[model samples]
Target chain A: MKQGPLDLSQHFLEEGVVDLSSSEKQSALEELCAITSKHAHVRDAKAFCKAIFEREKLVSTGIGLGVAIPHVKIPSVTDYVITVGRSEAGIDFDAIDGQPVRLVFMIAASEKQTAEFVRVLASIVKLVKQNDVRSRLLEASMPNEFCSILREASR
Target chain B: MNARTLVDHIRSSAATGRLLILCVIIGAIAGVFCVAFSWLLETVQYYLLDGLAHHESEHPVWIWLLVLPAFGGLVSGVLTTKFAPEAAGPGTDAAVDAYHHHGGRVRTRVPFIKMITAAVTLGTGGSAGREGPLTQIGGGIGSFVATGLRLSNQERRILMAAGMAAGIGAMFHAPLAGALFAAEILYREMDLEHEVIVPSFIASIIAYSIYAQKAGWEPVYAAPHFHFRNALQLLAYAALAIVLAASATLFTRLWRVVRDAFSSLPVPTALKPAIGGLIAGSIGVFVPDALGTGHHLLAGAFASSFSIGFLILLVTAKMVTTSLTIGSGASGGKLGPSLVLGGSLGSIVGLVVQDLFPSLEIDAGAFVVVGMAGFFAAAANTPISTIIMVSELTGNYQLLVPSMLVCVLAYLFVSRHGIYDAQLVSRLEAPSKMGNMLGAVLKTIAIRDAANHTRDLIVVPEAMSLRQIIDLYTSSEQLAFPMVDPDGKLTGMIEGRDIRRAIAEEGVADLVVARDLARPHEVIDIESTLLDAVQRMTLTGLEDLILVEAEDPTRPVGVLEHQEVLHAYDRKLMEK
Candidate 1:
């Protein structure tokens, strides 16, 4: 299957809503769970969060250049999915640039799709390097606008 | 010519013309040094062996085993401590430090110290390569020349690169590889402007030509040619690349381990090298091929005559010798020893695989060359330079594809953890905080403070006429003013945009107060962090942000913008 920005939406964004804040971590986690439970096949948002947290403990997914790519390989999904989220308020993810992350791409993939998942992740990194595309995504106001901006960028 | 005249002459020459001349000078100088360095080393070897070649009948191998390394270690220790301290150990770090921080200037005395010390170290059988010292020598020459000419920082950097290329070309007689090494490995980037490329190429070619004339052009290695008979062999080649990458990592780790161990010791610094030499010589007693640079042994491996067991022994011995020699504080290059060790590993792998699958006709030597480049790329993180170096040294462009593939694979494998630990620390020290803060402060002081001071001085009745507000901007530098309606609420802000756009397009100067140019979202709350303020600016793509009191949303506190933050940080750094 040809995976693109839609796959990212399904994997990263929990529901139709994404929460962004500076001082509160729990609110962000709760919002992530609410969104995932609505859009994701896995009904347990807590388990998904646990897996992502474990991955983060291994190495900060905040690769330099103001980007954070957090991923997990979970048995709950039979296929791979990726999602992107923007926080205009900026979250402290311990990024290499010492700058808080404004964009997050969360990925969930099955063991069988490891190579394909990695290839897609590399492509996403390349895509985000475009200054204009990143700026447009950061400025997106709502879920519909965010999705539209991602779709146009991928195209 | 006088120094000033010489500097002026160099500066006036077209970039290409100056580079060509510099390259020729570097090449000639490097070639002479290489020949002298080689001869001096051979003399030490002869004295240590008592004028007897390897197969001499009566000479006790034990005498060579004991005396040579002891002498090498002691000499290296004394030379390093007494003379050029910067020339101690492997030359790579010195080059990197000079390039990044020293404005591409190395002391002229460094090359002389390196040549003498390296020759003595290699001569008595110090387990290191000559190439590293030669690179330092070349780099030093470039630095000295540029400094003498008083060149601009950019020009000096290019000249230093050119000198390094010339040195590599002279030492290896690989011109193209030398040029690429300068642009790729030394710089750590492939994107080069005309200014860098022109000089680098000229220097490499000149160095190669001079060395070739003196040495009569020796190929790095000679091998029997073989063609792939089936697609399965390509798979074998891919497998070879994977193994090479892993081995490269091991080599890099071993070097680090030895360096750390020696450096952690409490002994007097000068004596450390002697101890390393003693250990290397003890190892050399069992494996005689580990004595010098191992060029002869590398040549032997390509002939399919070196046994797999012997190759393994050589690899271990060379690794220990090189690590100890360099780790302890000997002045030398890691490039030659790394290539030799990596080539031996590949050759052994090829021999074992061919033996198991007797039907497959594969030349192990071809794998050796590819392994050399692959290992260098992985260890050094310079794939382009390694690829080009291998192709140029062997004069075999046909191996480019395999070389490139192997190099890239090896590079990726090693990069997961990374080879250079120091680079990670340095990269973390970017000027991000200072830059951002300075940008913010500058914007505030330049625009906001001036406006606020004017507002305090200029007082008008609540029902100010449009003519008076226009007169305020006309009489002073405050082009914009916040207008408060009679109810003490800030109704709007007026600026040049409204007046100029009206005058230019509508052709009317009907005057208005600050309320005319006020946009709905021009104000920000006071409680936000500086990061928030910066993001708002970034998102709106605006030059300024108007600050309003949080308790009273309509009342203006002050304005903050890009320049305010920048100026503050700039002043802070200047004071420091």
Candidate 2:
């Protein structure tokens, strides 16, 4: 597939996992925003990437155990959205434990959707915290399998 | 005291009781100051010209008048210039400026200097009143007390205004009116300094009682007994209001013109008052009653009537002499002169109307009383206080309704301008109130007015590559971008900054998808306001917010940038 619009499933479509082409946190954010632009309603791709990077600059969003959640409240989007970018090769996201990040969850929201934005973030954090879910997400090799695992974990 | 201690003192509730006690002391001091000031001015006049009144010298004793005023002015000028330059002009202006700008601080020496200078000015027949000096003396006492107590600026202002009320109350024996004047005179528009009202009343009453112990508890002016017999008399009073307001407007403008002329004179500043005294002294040579505060003349006008022509001439003479006296920096209050003019104008109208219809029992004294109130209302833009003050001055409460009618009419007629340059339009315009005004503006303005419509935004697809985004960024001036899914459901926003970062990272752009790289931003519904947007923005540390269709949260409408909201706020304020 020449790759349809950057869908939620498309993020994990390539062998159910994405490789970290970027070396560091900043480049990883840039790469993720660039690919996400294929489907996200972003007016400016670079702005979207920089906003997430700016959020990352305050404190490393890399929670630990090879997971990072980078988010931004920007004027460009009309709704809350979540995209998962798996970096199998391991990217230097400056995780709390000083470990490289393997799973990257980038969330984008409008300035007004505060309640939904917060709720979605909490859900994402909860889903990522489950040991079985993390193992399943790490083991999945197909887009359907990853999507099913995320759906179950989210529920 | 150190800054921290001062701040702590101001924050404490104990300061309020301390300030109230201080106000009582200042009021008593101001009352005594007024009495002593009046006595000194009288003594000076007695020594200067009163003794010469019965002189049998071949040379007309009036010849001594020519130099007496000039001499008084010269001495007054020297005293003011040498001791307290702020005490030079009508003291009320200095006191007003002190309250508005100087944190309610006046030099401790000002009241003493003003007393001596104003005494010389009036005693030597400088054609001025005692109220101006009394006002400064009272205000100085308030400042002295406040400074001694180490009170906060707010407490100082209250006491200062109270002191002023005390002085005026003692001088006129009208405590209520004095309190009202202190609160009302600081602003040109119909705004009262409400915080000072209770303190001012307390001070004024104390001062009035103390002063009345010496001056006797009688009204300042005595009027012939009169009653509002018929409703038709209201028409005459209404006419009096219109005419007096016109005269007062003319008087106010002329005073400013004369003051400006004297200000531009090339002579030494100290000699300016002397020159003004010379002209007033020459006029006084003929109409000596026009000199001093015009109290005696104003009293006479109310007691009896002169010919219409003579009364009119007295009005003109009093106006000219007063403008010369105070406008040229002679120490005096325009209040006394305004009362004299109003009385003279009223008596003239009474004479004409009485002559026109002999059947109508039109009391000229009633007109005189009404004129005093209405004229000051026009000049000072203090209708309620002027009416009350005039009634209190004449010891007549029955004339309240008529006086109120005329006072209000006169005030409305010429209230567009005022004699006090230090007067602000209202508390809203005061420097202290600006922060509150800004808060009010932010709270009141809706997002609909502040937001930039979605159609005005630069929209780009979520699937667009970083290279394509860079191309769009260079082409458009938009700072915000709304990302959409394949179904066109609004998914995420990409600020222009993020795109630049992507391009800056070089090779990372090709590998990363826009959806995964996109950051989720807060969305504002169309129905929300700027206050809501600002609150959310502050909470999330965001500068710009996306607006969505109210019916559908997922549908992008417009962008509400922080800068745009601020611009709208500015426009709204300017409109106000």
Candidate 3:
């Protein structure tokens, strides 16, 4: 899925949020919302969690390769937004393996953006599976750098 | 104090805050303890075997074989009976049971007892590998640290994995393999985050460095330089994968047969290993290289000293010895022994192939290395770790492609199962019919008492109302409920949180029934294996399951809870 740089960048990054160490799902949802708001058009955390859970119910989205793609089709989200969060401290996402999740990619897309959304997801999966690309993405210093890496990896 | 104050106080209590810190400290302590245990065992084995090898240098190797194995078996039998009975069998099953059922709580003394007992077993020339005891020792150390630090159940489980990694790394001097070993073999997938990989790497490297510094580096096997000409050889390697896969299946089946046979015996359990040892010892008399863990024979094969005929004999003898040793209840490992056996088998195969086609020369040692990785991958169903391990062991990065191919093929070939059937069984949703039969026999013999006790006491009536469910929950302390419709059709489930949420949000007096709030989720089928249950639970993050008739999910038969299963397993261990 190839999307413009600005759109793809907005899909995955949020700025100025400190690292979270909380184990509660609500706290994680709040953190996710905060980060996602800076990138996409998310109204609130609850709506995001509901959308993600609905998607989860349809399919685990765990993907089984240590990566989980939690996305939502919500009208509140204006554009296709993907937010990537790395938990230095692991969070229990009820991951398929009963193991805590470290890296999370949350996708927010409108109903009309099916093809683009799928392509973006496929690109992310392919990039994440590559050791070099994932390492660079994980080590990106700021929102801009993270966005740049994602754009570069997508290409 | 008010309710808010009490809740805050409980959250900030010294006990709760310390649990997280305890987990980290436990991980570090466990790492150190695993190294110490491994070193201790190795030292004992070295000294004991050093004397025997020296004394037998002047005589025929056959005499030393009989004496060494007999002595090892006797010592193993005596130590198992006198001290730690738990140390008598492969430690992986115990570790797995403890992890799932005991909240990673293992007796601190178990590692020490296992270290000494396993050392005696190996030192006396028992035909078992050391990896099993190492895992138990590592797990015990992890438990010790967790208990000492008072970590939470979740953190303790992580520490258990870290400890296992450390032990495997130290034992084999393969840090990457050790780390992956913990993540892949025990967890059945790479569940830990990339961040945890750093700690696992650090622990494994530290432990392995300490071991290597003290013991010096010992190559797992030597390899003669072999040139790879074309993609054709890679195809040949792929063909060889079939052989490796078949061999791995045979090894696993043989091990199961031996275990089942011995467990079926009416005699005292303590005496079984002695009988096994006698069989292994007799084999060792004819094939001296089959004695002990056979690391020396592996080295010999790599150096091209062992002939094809001798390789055949060693492979057969080693397989039988290992099967008997483990079957008889001797606490040991199969990894090293399997590698040796696979290597020998590969060498023999390579020789026969080369003899048939003299023009197409193939290096036997190279085939041996490929065989080692392929067999391990097939038997363990861990292809990535197997490929990486063989590459690292041989220090031949060039072999990675062939190794990967063979490992993957072998894994595909044995896609049906693994040598560690208990591990596979544990991952299932319910025990198989064979497992049920075994469980029944164990119960009849009163051996089931040692297993962990699970209290699956909560039951829900088909006609219960939502108000009644709420009242029952408020009156009692149960956390889960099985919801059945008026006609006794399995509908869904309601948990403590579900009821509380419904009451808080919708009002308890709204006349909403349990059926209205019940969440219809997938019910675990009766025929589903225990491993399947665990995997599904893990995937869904469900703590309780509704057991329904296999033919129909609408018919509710019983309820199963994660805690109850864990308790039942604990009872099993206690009985043991």
**What tier of docking accuracy does candidate 1 attain?**
incorrect
> Model 3: runs farther than 4 Å from truth?
A1-155, B1-50, B53-58, B61-64, B187-198, B217-219, B222-227, B357-361, B424-576
Q: What is the interface RMSD of each candidate, in Å?
A: 27.2, 14.2, 18.7
Ranking, lDDT, top scorer first: 2, 1, 3
Predict model 1's lDDT versus the native.
Answer: 0.66
lDDT of each: 0.66, 0.77, 0.65
lDDT at residue B286 of model 2 (Cα atoms)? 77
Instruction: For residues B45-161, write the lDDT of model 3, one tens digit per residue.
Output: 667655655322435355555666556666666777677776777776677567656777778777877777677666656777777677777777777776777877755766676
Compute each candidate's TM-score over C-alphas: 0.58, 0.65, 0.55
The number of the candidate with the highest DockQ is: 2
| B327-425: candidate 2 lDDT, tens digit per residue | 888777777778888888988887777778666778888888898899988888788789899988988887888899999999888856877777778
Best by lDDT: 2
DockQ of 2: 0.02
Badly placed stretches (over 4 Å) of model 2 are A1-155, B1-16, B53-60, B443-565, B568-576
